[model samples]
Target: MDMSETSQPTIDEVDLLLANARLRDELEPYRDESIDTSTGRMNLRTENEYLASMLAWERAPALPIASWFTPVLELPPPDSLDDDSLNELLSATIEKLYSQKVVLRFTDHLSNRELYKIIYRDILPCCEKKVEIPGKFLEWRCFEDTDTWLRYYADAVERRRYQEEHDVRMPPSERPKYRRDLPH
Candidate 1:
């Protein structure tokens, strides 16, 4: 192979550049994060991925969090009718939120009814901001006050684990990393 072939990126550079360009094409799209992908080209695939993620987050739509829980969403809030009603509502809620690129975390403490109430009263207020772009989402922090939620709500196993890990016996935040990607 010629020195240029090894020293410079091949046509694969065009593919990476094109993929980056596609990011912006979704909604009048515009973006680029190129990986040389050529052998001995100082692998930039990881960096490119990170840069692409950062760019998406920077350009994503900013919407109030409450909009996510509105009745207008794909799944409506659960009715407080019967025993199974709350669970059904929660199942639907998780699915709808996931589809909309929302994730909830650190919520082992609250019962189904309580969790729903917070979504209705607190999350539905739509005051908090969330960044949502294609392949990205806005993470809304849930009830994660260590002094309160963790102290009172955490189960014995969770509390013991937390104590063992931190020694401070308190969570860094009542909720941690609310906006998380689905487990890959």
Candidate 2:
């Protein structure tokens, strides 16, 4: 039997299940809290925490999902500033990308052409810089030529992986399971 030929549920189906599970878990907390009269009017911090936890739970798995949903761009920082300033700009850009879940696909062994594509096609046009790297790697005049961009990208990737693992490792009871095929 050719396993490759076997039909499998689409991402939409899995997404539906995930959505249901999220709702179920979110509601469960509210239901449990409703029993306690003293739990009325949740504080801002508490509310924020609850929302954060719920969101984390929901988005933990299937990270880099933004790559699928959002358009990719490659734009670099402005060249008018000195190397130090450029590094700062690059750091800020990396942070913004991480927060926004933008995937920066680059490897340590990236060629100048590859770097240019990432800069011009993905990072530059969308971001402020629009600067291109003339060398194989970003030269670090201050500390070391440690491709800070790649570091940030790796961090984002690792964060997603950790979240995905956490989601999978969560106890079945703690994680809500909903059957999509069932009538609502």
Candidate 3:
């Protein structure tokens, strides 16, 4: 075999070389003991792959959530959508968001319209770091309150512990107004 034939790198190898160089360049400023002084546990290829993934996450762009979708997610005004239509759209939208690794939490307290409105006006339009790291999901909280968790998720013992810890009277626990089977 000709020496050139054996020496030439394939297209995939070239791409990997370029990507590794780019990752090294991007990580240069942040170079520290964490990566450079890492214990000799991971082999060179595995270490480089892990470093490349961390660099990719660090360099991800922050853009409107809707722009993350292929065709771009757009929903009509919540008021115009009837209850049935809103519910249908909400379910589909939740699935779409989940497909993009976005999860909604504590949504049972909001009505269908309220939840939809938040997804439409707040989450869909909000700018967030679009990290493509696997096993990483962005959690969107529909309502902001510790009391909500205490009321809805906490067991009787947990609630009593919270009351004792905070020395505050616990509100009577009631079922959330609307039930949504959202992704965790």
Best by TM-score: 3
Q: Model 3 over residues 1-184: C-alpha lDDT tens digits?
A: 7777787887877777776677778888877666562526875466568877777666899999999998999999999988999999999999999999999988888888888999998999999989988788999977768888887767899998999999998877978978777777
What is the per-residue lDDT of model 1 for residues 1-184, given as tens digits with 9 covering 90 to 100? Answer: 6786576666788777676555434424343344322234334554456556655555655565546556554334546445487767766766676666667654555667766776666665555445444666546555656665665457778887878888874644444323233321
Report the Cα lDDT for candidate 2. Answer: 0.40
TM-score of each: 0.52, 0.24, 0.69
Candidate 1: C-alpha lDDT: 0.57
Off by over 4 Å in 2: 1-77, 110-117, 124-184
Residue 179 lDDT, candidate 3, scale 0-100: 77
In model 1, where do residues sit more than 4 Å from their true spots? Answer: 1-6, 14-42, 65-71, 74-83, 127-141, 148-184
lDDT of each: 0.57, 0.40, 0.84
Best by lDDT: 3
Which is the better candidate, 2 or 3, if ranked by lDDT? 3
- Root-mean-square deviation per candidate: 8.4, 23.3, 6.8
Give model 3's TM-score versus the native structure. 0.69
